[model samples]
Target: MEAHSASYLRWIVVLLLVSSCIEATSFSKVKHKNAYATMMYVGTPRDYEFYIAVRVLIKSLSALNVEADLVVIASIDVPHRWTQALEQEDGAKVVRVENLDNPYKHQNNFDRRFKLSLNKLYAWSLVDYDRVVMLDADNLFLQKTDELFQCGQFCAVFINPCVFHTGLFVLQPSMEVFKEMVHELENGKENPDGADQGFISGYFPDLLDKPMFHPAPNGTKLNGSYRLPLGYQMDASYYYLKLRWSIPCGPNSVITFPGAPWLKPWYWWSWPVLPLGLHWHEQRRQTLGYFAEMAVMLIQSAIYLGIIAMTRLVRPSLSKLCYRQSDKSINLVHNSLKLVALWCIVAAYVIPFFIIPYTVHPLLGWSLYLLGAFALCSIVINTFLLPMLPVLVLWLGIVGTLMVMAFPWYPDGVVRALAVFGYAFCYAPILWASMVKITAGLQLSLEREAFLPRLGEPWPPSSFKLY
Candidate 1:
């Protein structure tokens, strides 16, 4: 009786283990058919802000416990590893798609973009999905939005009183609709935005009609719907306009950054520290920390401010410490050094063209080369082509990027070490001189004052003018 009892216990344990295995498999493998989908497209990882936002959107969805099917339609430009992360980490089904043909390919920044606005049209081609919620990567979800799946074939939010925002929309996927939309695009019916939103809005112009109308699925009823609530797609830019004291429109589910792409949340410097800043902070993406990034900015700003500060604070001390030298020689030597430094910095940027010209598209390669050359020439030779501050920011950003990339294409030597240092000092003395001139209330007419133009701007006209 004891032996029989022990045998039965062992058999029971085996049955329990097998049952648990089956249960685990059932839980992990959710079927795609008849499930609602939230779809995004990623063509490149180069757009750091958009990429981070996309990750946050997926993570937020998981946090909300919304089991909607996650899908990413991607182009070949997006790396396979990203597709793997979407599948394994975010539970997404990544469908590879070819970039749509663009008649404006050469003239316009359409599908050939870090913008990738054209890729959104691919959502219409997802015939397998029961319903699709298309979201631009620049959006963040605040709460669970699974109920949107219950929405009709088309549903969107209207941020403006009249114009509906296309960043977020709910639609049923259909190849028939996709082909027709493509046909419309082919015939040049794109909206003013010149993105996929343009083509979509043109195709379905009656979005604002009361009891909104949308395409029926295979002779299904012409289902009409209500507008998506204002809170569903909150444009944070409206904080200064309409939402002053509180979010006047009630609780928000999704926040959309509909402004210039550069002003996105990841760029902490552009956003202020109040209602807008805190919302972005709450998202708390596991990135190189904002404060850490701020520290970098602070260091950069200090370097900038130091020059300005010195110009104001050190005039009394400057004459005390050193003998008066020939001002023209000082200006000429310092300016020449700055020009050399600027050249090294631009050359550092142009290094990629030298190293990986074959990998990049020919047009891109030549464009980068030409652009870098123009920047270098602008500072040293052609001063008035582009304004100074914008060029300075571009130069600094490029230098910072090269520092992070560790000057990869550069040859390792003492020469490389000197080149790096040379790039850092590009604006050092010039910025100081410019500030000194500004503090002293000097006129900086570039055409009239040859010294300031050659030596770099805003400096007081030298009494001992080189000319």
Candidate 2:
């Protein structure tokens, strides 16, 4: 029996080995085919806008008859809600990179985040692909881009006339090349300035190449070589037109930045009336209108409460300490009072700061009339739903206010007041606390004996601590 079992086991092992070899051979062929396949990479914090961009890309690619894969590398904390949305899209794969360590881990800084994202992209070089293209989450595809595959070399990029926009680019993935790039970036070998574009450009100085630029129709400055015509990548703003409209184009034409298009300097004149020359401007406008409506609703609620109180429609009831009834009643009353207080504060202070200026800015002959119109539209739409808008807006508003206060761009006293009251109030406390902690920690460490040196030393060890 033992001899028979041993023979059977040997045969099973042999069969398993043969299966493994067959699988390996199959995988190699697949890799070879995929080598020529075009792929686009988009990284985001996993939000609705990201999914929207993915859907648009998938549809555009399908129309172009291009065989492509959509790769999304997201952090672990990305919500599962995005998973379902991405999975539902054809030719899309969402990859969650676990235990990923960001070399640049400075949180809350935009520059640091951008550097970390580039590093993450470099890390993705290990992923199976012949060529890779990186696109921002806010972008919308206009047409089929199968031609991008033909341009593959060491690296292919879309050049903007104004700046080197890293929002989109095509490159072959090489682990060795990526590692060298990372080492150069981290060690400040090639780019001491720490700019990712400078490092990439310097590394492949000899390999930079551009394709032909497709010219646009006359009277439409939107379609010229400046519009990412061919090897050239233009700012999405170049398509900006009267009343916020933009020209439509696809896989070849993409919307780089979507969420805050109104905040862009060029769009300031057109303001809220986003040009509809593009495909998704209506959706973008709807999103903006949604947020604006939220603010207006919040203001309306406050008005409702104030009027109710003035008419004595709802009386404030007092409750004394008790075992069960008072406990429940007091809790309810406390919550109610808190809600009323918050609503009043938001209505009186927060909403007015944005709304009053927005309303009067146009009528009072302030230069940005389009901005006022946009703000008004937003407020009117959101008047009933402001209370449900995400609380992040408050946090964002505070941070924005603080930046203005710290910088003090306005010369006039009124502008200064607006800056202080609007921006400073939200950000000053947290900023002050962070500064205090850093200073105190440094002082404490400096005063410590461990940080000092023994006698007869060339210099106190603490002296080097300043570095």
Candidate 3:
């Protein structure tokens, strides 16, 4: 029985080896097909922000049910937490690579924001795929773009009149082209802008004049570089001009926010100001949700509530100490108390601005800030017996300034900056006048014993300490 079992095991091993060889031979002839690819790297201040943006893009693509694999060419330095989230949560295949050296770093005009941006060049090394659509995180897709795989060796949209936008482009993977690109970089090739945009644009200088690409219906991949219609990459700025899309060719499929980094659609406050931002947030609401920020927001809300309650409880005592009518000998003490009250009011507004998370949904962010400011200002108001309007003018000014800056009607960024400066210039005098009014009111209250009944209680000894 033992001899027979040994004979059966040997036969099984031989059959397995033969089958593996046959499968390997057959697999060598099959192409791996296509993928939608983007890159992620560290060394920038906005690393986490970009990471969140990329995950949203990947999840959005999955929601569209595009007929391609999702790929991320991430640098090895990127945290395991982010890469794991991309793989397990967002359904992305992450390929880790070393950061590509940018030879143009010594150039006078090199922008540090692109320090690790050259890592994007690794997209061409993805030779396993027959075709790849390389993208920037800021690209918002409105529809499935599976047809992009049928384009040629290189295809891009010309959002600018003379230059194609790299925010979204189709490229066929080839080791030779990738090697030549690295060679050109090492040889100090003339990259006018010293960033990935200028380097890639310089490498494909004639794409602007190429004939537009039209994907073959029979699913045949074409050859040569071609220009994609503007519809494939409608700049976000275009929609702001008309408040709607009017692209007349191809598919009005992707929106690229290439203007300002801070105004990316994923940011909660970007919406209503940029109406299209609401669409991006809607996608996020469905897919990723806001759970990541919910805990911090709740904690802040509770702290604000505690502050308001504690201030209310201590109101009569604070008022008794500070709001009493004084003789000439107590005038120095009175002036010092007034300065301290003003400082506390200023801190009330400033403290909340920093404590609130920078990327929380705009509505939540604004709401939390208002709550915190109101809570802190209550201490000052109850103690000094001051009016509400003067304390809140500064808060109102900040909100108004944000609205002015976010107005979508500005023809260009230059106009937007000028408008913000104009608003500040006009509002500075008003803010100063409000501060003077607050000071005057506080002084008058200190000289009168009957400012408010709650504050008219007998004062403690002059040496009394809050501590």
lDDT top scorer = 3
Q: What TM-score, over all chains together, does every model reach?
A: 0.54, 0.44, 0.79
Q: lDDT tens string, model 1, 1-467?
A: 89658645654453344334334423545465333333345545444445455655666666677756676666546667766776787776666655554444544444455245666777776666667788876677778776666667778888887777788888887766776766565555645656766666666778788553333345343344446777778887655343332454535678887876445665443333123544554664432123423453345345435544443332221111122235556555444444544465456346534432221222233344445443343333222222344335545544453453244344333444566567658746665554354323212222233433333334443323121
What does candidate 2's lDDT look like per residue over 1-467, in tens digits? 89658645654453344334334434533322222221223353323434444444544444555555555554445566655555464444554433223333443433442443443344225346655566654445555554443334343344444334555655565656654654454444544334445555566554424434332334121211122343234344544422222334322354555235333212222222233222443333332223423465456445545543442332211111112233346446434544543354345334434433221111121222222333432332122112222222444444454345335245544555565676556666755554355334433432343433233334322221110
Ranking by lDDT: 3, 1, 2
- Kindly list the per-residue Cα lDDT of model 3 for residues 32-132, writing each as its tens digit: 37889999999997887788889889999999988888888887789999999998999888777767667788889988898778777777877778899
Would you give me the overall lDDT of model 2? 0.40
The Cα RMSD of model 1 versus the native structure comes to: 18.9
For all candidates in order, the CA lDDT equals 0.53, 0.40, 0.79
Model 1: colliding residue pairs: none
Error of 1 at 177 (Å): 1.1
Stretches of candidate 3 exceeding 4 Å from the true structure = 1-32, 316-347, 383-385, 396-433, 445-467
TM-score result, candidate 1: 0.54
